[model samples]
Target chain A: MKRKEQKTFIAAFLLPPLLLYALFVLWPAVNAFRYSLTRWDGLGSATWVGLYNFRNILARSSEFMPALEHNVFLMVVPGIITLSLALFFAYVIHQRIRGARLFRIAFFFPNIISSVAVALLWVLIYSASDVGLLNNLLRLINPKHEMIAFAESSRLLWALVPMIVWSGTGFYMVLFLAAMENIPDSFYEAARLDGAGSFALFRKVTLPLMWDVLTTGIIFLVIGGLKIFDVIWVMENGRPTTTTHTMATLMYSKVFEEYNIGYGTAIAVLLFILVLLATMVSFRLLRRERLEY
Target chain B: MQRMLGGAGSGLKYAILVLYLLAVVFPMVWVLYTSAKSTQEIYQNPFGLPAAVTAPSAKTLETPIENFEKAWVGSHFSSYFVNSVKLVSISLVLILLLGAMAAYVLARFEFRGKGLVYYLFLSGLLIPMQLILIPLFFQFSDMGEALTRLLGPITERLGLGYLTVSLHDSHPGLILIYVAASLPFTVFVLTSFFRTLPGELREAAMIDGASEYRIFFSVMMPLGKPGLVTVAIFNFLGLWNEYLFGLVFLNSDHLKTLPLGLASISMQAQYKSDFGLLFAGLVIAMVPTLLVYMFLQERLTKGITVGALKG
Candidate 1:
């Protein structure tokens, strides 16, 4: 192909997608910063408020702080539960247990459904009414037992612990399993011959080899935890109180519901920074020299 | 030959796997059954059959699909279902076409600023959509109004009605955002995929006097089917289940997607004793995904692992 022709082809191929991406994603991302700085309600023109919005959100108000705390709790709690369960399941499945394929498929079932559906399913289970599955089970176990209002705003975060873990473990399990599969059979064989027990072989060989993938999984968990909205949004019936609000939900409700565009974008800006920092910090804290076989 | 792990260890493994599997699947199964039950039966026999045993041999049974009927026809999930299908399919097509075009270029050519442009797309993978949501709404609406003004005369002449392109609260607008949001990951996956294909195929096609466009459409695309399918399935499922963008950008009731519709139904279920209807809605929202997973389980798992592992 001629040099000029090649250039034109590249230009033609790249321009449309890049243009759409910039207009929708990149440009708006930059605009998020500008909007965060102004006092606009997303309608009439706004005055520049400088750092007032950020200061008010980060310092002045108790609301944003509690929301941030909830986000952190969500990140740490579900992150621990999901990763541990995923790692354990991945290891056991890696053992080629009976019906391992069926187990793998079943474990990943929740990942196939939408987040909203998962939340709704859990809500039904946790409902305090006669139709509620958990409540019904409790009622059957003991006649004196009362139905728990598990879906209330105050208790929603605790409720979300199991919901998030249940849906998330399979994806990470598949992730770690894929990584584990890449380790040579010779390594495991060598370890076994050296009298390394099952746990020892996993610890000595599997863990180090799969560190990169595990880091990626952790990063995925952290980012996902921080941005969580749908589960809390649906489970709370789209009316998140202070007790249940995460940063993403708070940002959405503030901007769209309250029309506080500036304040909401401020939350967005903080969320962006927080995700970046958490990802970076996780990578740093988990970093080790890679071991090659 | 299998090495002998103790029977105790094997039993423990089976026990753990079965336990977790039950924990995972029981909710969905329970919801399926509950969706079939009448409201009264739901209250009386929460975990039992949908029929009441009035005598030793005779039982009264309610139609299992009553809840589905109520949620679909009565509650208007049918319309929302159509809207979701429209949005997801249109977005899937655009993402694949545009994503393939860009991925092909990035994989095959050496151009100035290629590295920078590649990283630009890569950076998008990390940036949260939450940051862009506020500005995106306003921008789309403004663009819609501008397009309406620009195309007003032509559209009127063409009998396309007041043909304006205001994307806000419309199918096209939602599709545009979905395509953009999915592009980064799609491009990343496909570019790596394209690079792995031997260049000799393109060289062979060039010797036959095939134009670049022909090369792309006929040769490259066919060769890249697995990668394309993987990316397409991932994007399709993601867009189908997407709630945040649809919830915020679309305001009209009829324009809402399944996730948004299900959410609205859930909120309304708070005051209404429509748990059966809600369960039916859950099952409706879930069927397509479950069906896709059942048939394409390999592709779905492989697609996810491909993207995550590559990252």
Candidate 2:
């Protein structure tokens, strides 16, 4: 192709997507910074409030602070359980135990469903009435046992622990399993030849070789934990209070529901910063020298 | 003694895996059963199977299928399902075409500001899209009027009356947002995929006087089918299940997607003792994705691993 034609072709190819992306994505992203500085409801004129939104957000008593705390709690509490269980399952599956394929598929089934649907499933499972599985089980175990309102906003975060872990563990397990599959069988053979027990072999051979993917998995968990909204939103029936709010939920309710455009944009900005910082910190904290085979 | 110990260890591993599997599937099984039961039956025997013969009446016997029918027709999930299908299909096509074109350019060309453009696309992956939610809403609100004004004259000249296009609370509005949000990751993946394809074929096509567009469409895109399919499936699954964008942009009842529709029913069911309908709605919402995942498990899993493990 001639130079002019080639340039035209390139422009033809790149311009459409780049234009749409910039208009919808990049422009709004940049505009979010400006929106953060103004106190405006979405419908009305935005005023120059400077840093007041940020100030209120950072104050101890603001809903944003507690929301952040909930996010952090989710990050730490579920993070550890999810990673550990995922690694365990991945390792077990790697061992080629009987029915491993069935377990893998069964576990991953939930990951394929919509987050909203998953939340609804959990809402049923935790329903305070007779339809609740947990409550029914409780009633069976003790005839007079009162049904627990597990889906209520006050208990919503704790209720999320199982739902998050259940839906999440399988993906990470499969990720690590894929990475494990790539590790040459000779390495495990060598470890066994060296008299390494199964536990010792895993710790020595499996974990080190799978470290890179595991780090990626952890980073994914962190990002996902911070961005959690749909589950909480659906579970709380789209009315999450401060106790159950994560950053994403808070941003949604504030801006969309309350029309606090400036405050919500400020939350969005902080959420972006938090996700970036968390990703960076996770990479830094989990960084290890690459193990070349 | 060593054999016994190994047997015990294996037993323990099996137990854990089985326990986890049961934990994973029990909720789905329970919901499925509950969807088949009446509210009275559910309250009376939450764990029991739906009665083999309910009141010996043909009308009330098939509560299982009836609940699903109610959810599909009565709760209006059928429209939501259609809406989700439309949104996902349109967005996936646009995302693939635009993403492939952009990825093809980035992979093959050495243009001015090439690195800058590539990084600009990559940066979209890191910035949590929730950050732009408010601005996005504002932009859509602004564009609603702007588009109407821009198109009004043309429509008037064409004798079609005033043409109005609102980006808020419309299908196209949500489609634009979904395509944009999914673009960064799609581009990043497809670029790397395109780079991996052998350059000899493209060079061969080039030497034969094929135009750049021809080479891209005929030589490259067909060759990049696997990558395109992977990206397509990933985008389909993500955009199909997307909640936030739809929640914010879709205000009308008819435009609600499956997740939104299901959410509304569940919320209403919280007050009303309509767990059967809620369970049925959950099934309606879940079945398509579930079936797709079951059939295309390898591709879906590959798509996920590629995004995460490729660094």
Best by lDDT: 1
TM-score, prediction 2: 0.97
- Alpha-carbon shift of residue A38 in model 1 (angstroms): 0.4
Please, what are the lDDT tens digits per residue for candidate 2 over residues B147-220?
88899989999999999888888898888888888889889999999999998998899899898889998989
Angstrom error of the Cα, residue A223, model 1: value is 0.2
C-alpha lDDT of candidate 2 relative to the true structure: 0.86
For model 2, the superposed segments whose C-alpha errors exceed 4 Å read B1-5, B52-57
lDDT of 1 by residue, A18-130 (tens): 99998889999999999999998877998899999999997777789989889889889988999999999998888786688998999998987899999988988998988
**By TM-score, how accurate is candidate 1?**
0.96
